[model samples]
Target chain A: MAQARQEDNATDAPPEALRAEGIVKRFGALTALSGVDLHLRKGEVLGLIGDNGAGKSTLIKTITGFHRPDEGQMYVDGEPVSLRSVAQARALGIETVFQDLALISELSVYHNMFLNSELTLKPFPLLDNRKMKERTKQYIDDMGVNIPSIDTQVGRLSGGQRQAIAVARSVYSNAKILLLDEPLAAMGAKEGAMILDLVQKLKNEGQVSIILIAHNYSHVFEVCDRVNLLQHGRISYDKPTSESSVEELTELVVAEYRKARTTS
Target chain B: MAKQAVGGDVGASESARSSPGLGSRVAELLLRQREASIFFVAIALAVYFQSSNSAFLSSGNIRSLSEFTYATAIISGGLVMLLICGEIDLSVGQAYGFAPIAMYLADQTLVLPVAVIVGLLATAVIGLINGVATVYLRVPSFIATLGMFFFLGGVNVILTDGFPKTAPSGSFLTEILGGADWSGIAWCLLIVLLMHILLNRTRWGLHTFATGGNPVGASEAGVKTAKIKVGNFMLCSALGGFAGVLDALRIGSIDPLAGGPNIMFFAVSAAVIGGTALAGGTGTIIGAFLGTVVLSIMQNGFSLQGVSAYTFNVILGIAILTAMTLNVYVGSLRRSGRV
Candidate 1:
């Protein structure tokens, strides 16, 4: 797989799996992302942190191709490309788990897993629900997930289970780069820990890269190899977690706040 | 106790034990599959009518009732699918009469088999138009088909010049398509079973359910929601045309003026009464079949009891409302985490 990806990305290649530079998005009078540059390495988790309206979500959206940047260049596996739609991004192995999770709550777990990519038999080529159900069991077990029934509707699962299923869907879709937007938001303390462990497990597998957005600084520090802080639609802080402490990131935010107050 | 019974999770007793079961799990399961109550209600009505009238349960009476309903039931199968895909085609009623008239017009110049083929193809084209208008033109299907309902009704008058067309008869095909030759029931049952397999066992069926359940979610997951909806529209009209031809052949003439919005309404109600949803994303073919059966039984009972036509209409209206209310209520309960 590594050799094939390298061969396909022989031209205009960058070392990172995904790279974005000078991304600027404007909404008439308001600018959502102003010249933001971010890069994700292979099999590494990058924590994205920001205050309210800090452009973190905007950057994630741009990366997932939900919103196109007015001025920017994006590269997938070293090849420069422009994505016009989320479907296009998915084709290039980019998957995003939005705050809403984009889940059909009324459908079964197995059905949702193969929502758009259902297995079909030859000749007649009808949906292979039995196979999908069996595969869903395998995927969940391999990921150490504890869903009660693969055939049960996703709406019946607990909040964290729902979040995990959404994350699992992205992983199971063969996503090369997974973007999670506040997956732990409003989750119970135990559920939050459970998801963190799952993310850590995916990280250990070393198959897909991760970009996680979270409000909790400690959780970010716990799971992220590196962290980026978005401020006023630009990435203001990028540092390795080993070299930077949570206290230091907190101080940077405080300093930025004081500077804003002084200027105002 | 009841809820757990309905939400039975085999091999997972811990969670089931932790949560109190309030509603009958059996009732809940019955509602989800949408079979138990409709079947029960139909049987109950059948029993009630049998007790009241000596002829109600007679084999001849039952067979005749089925013969009356087979065409509409066939059309309802298609409506059940379309409704599940979150759309409707009111033009079906017109297509039913229109196809036979087209067949009659073509038969004047061509052979019977060729004329029949032309009629079916023409109806398929109309169905394609309905699908394209709704999907590509971005017009809501309800309004687009409503326009078709009126436009096609006007076309019926223009085609036969305001007179019932004398249909060419005594053909083997007509006997199979309609007539009291038992072939009509066989064809209807064959279509119903084929449709049931398509909805439950095919990828197309899964896509239909996904498209209706959540279009955005389905699209994001890579489903072609618009395509599925359009396909269902065509399926609905084609079946509507087929049913129309059957009814015309059985009655021995084509009456454009006789069938209007009423037939389409009856078919839709039959689907809903059986447990197919009006709001989409949920339905069953068996339920729709049962629904048509119940309506047929009720209509037969009313006429036998010597009820006036106007009184029977009121009673039928009440029946539709009660069935729809029950359907919607069961739906809401399911959404609240029972099934």
Candidate 2:
């Protein structure tokens, strides 16, 4: 029945842009992700909140095709899709901005922006550096990304600026579904505002879907349309941001913590 | 990427005005690093040696020094590529000798040209073995290539019974590969120029830098790091093979122990002194070329001045140590944001 729904393409649109059902990932004897189901409709931001070792990162890795699930079903636009590599996920218009930012420290901003997807003329694999640099400058300006120059190495920048670059890179990849793993950490006031605005713009366009992993409830409350609380490798709470309050999310986490403490 | 950035010209005029200053500052920073230091050391050594023996600056001595650096420079090109890709092939030294020995063994049956091809094929096979052992077998390149080094060297010795082969003298293959004149130097220059372009201007080269800088990052970015490394291993072995053949042609004979680990050590030192980081992610082909020149100059100058072998080794060792220490220091400066 799940396979049939995924294959149904007669309708004009699918219910969800990206979805995963029963994702289970194991590393040796330990299960990183056990039966985690996630949902994000088109043009929606789903905030993923979790405590330490709550398997948020593992879920992201599985979805991004970094760590293939040991057992699971992943669907794109209601079509069953198997993601075997990051490149495959990218081809499906699913781009991820990892917390590490995935930027080469030695490379310049422009180089990092086009790290895997470089511009090159046909018949020869030489880089079009001029075009790449120009395009990167254009992107930074449009996004108001606080960068000194396109030529500056990403490592030389402050942590906030590096985060800005990662967001810009994902946004530039033209992703239909973007995953940001703690993108706001170390982000400065101005840069954070710019990234927030960028996400808002993409959300409003009704063309992109987003899944953000954020620790702060306030940030999640601001822009995320819905929130899912991942507890112990499972979704313990899921609701629209309007239906949920910070006090309620905090109470839920605190209860879980107390329960775990008492049980242990 | 996303329909191209719409408003890209906001600060174009302003940054254009500062472009000249920024460009120069970047260049100044680059020169402040390891490359310039080694260049100056090479020049200073030249001046000092020339002052001692007027013949040190003679055209004959200069030509000889240039020729001496040819094989080392060619092999150093591949070594630098491998090193930058986060692996090293110590077997290039033995692979070098193996190429010529393969040719020599083949020459006993086949024609000279056929023998050269066989020799080159032999090196490629050795390269594949080294690459497979490292990439597939999960052996670290240092240990894998080191094992190949001894294994190949022993094979050359055992097969030849420790006797040198008379290099084929009159064939067209001999004329070209042996460098009837300074052709080996030309080959070295061509290889350096090609590799320089490959390392800086091409996508493959960018992938190389990415792989060396952060293997995990590069892999995540869709770069097949394993394939890149394996390709580099093959390229290094091929270049080693070419250099081995060229050296045999020039020397008029193939010494059973011609391109030993000691010689590979000198080539590696040239790369390190030239700013190719032993730790990877940083290096320049031109720097490697100049480093080979400096090493050759030291050897030539010291020998001309009647320095004993023991003293020459000691002095050369000290010089290399000092140069490499400087390289490490400058590299740290880059990490600290000085570059």
Task: Please write out the lDDT profile of model 1 over residues B169-203, one tens digit for every residue.
Answer: 78677776786566677888899999999998887
Deviating ranges (above 4 Å) for candidate 1: A1-15, A251-264, B1-29
Model 2: DockQ vs. true structure: 0.51
Expressed as tens digits, the lDDT of each residue in A51-131 for candidate 1 is 999888888878888898999999999889898988889999999988777677767898888877789988888878889
Second chain TM-score for model 1: 0.90
After superposition on all CA atoms, how large is the RMSD of candidate 2? 6.5
For candidate 2, give the lDDT. 0.85
**Total residue pair clashes for candidate 1:** 10
The most accurate candidate by DockQ is 1
Tens-digit lDDT track for model 2 on A107-168? Answer: 88999899888998668778899999999999988776679999988878887778778878
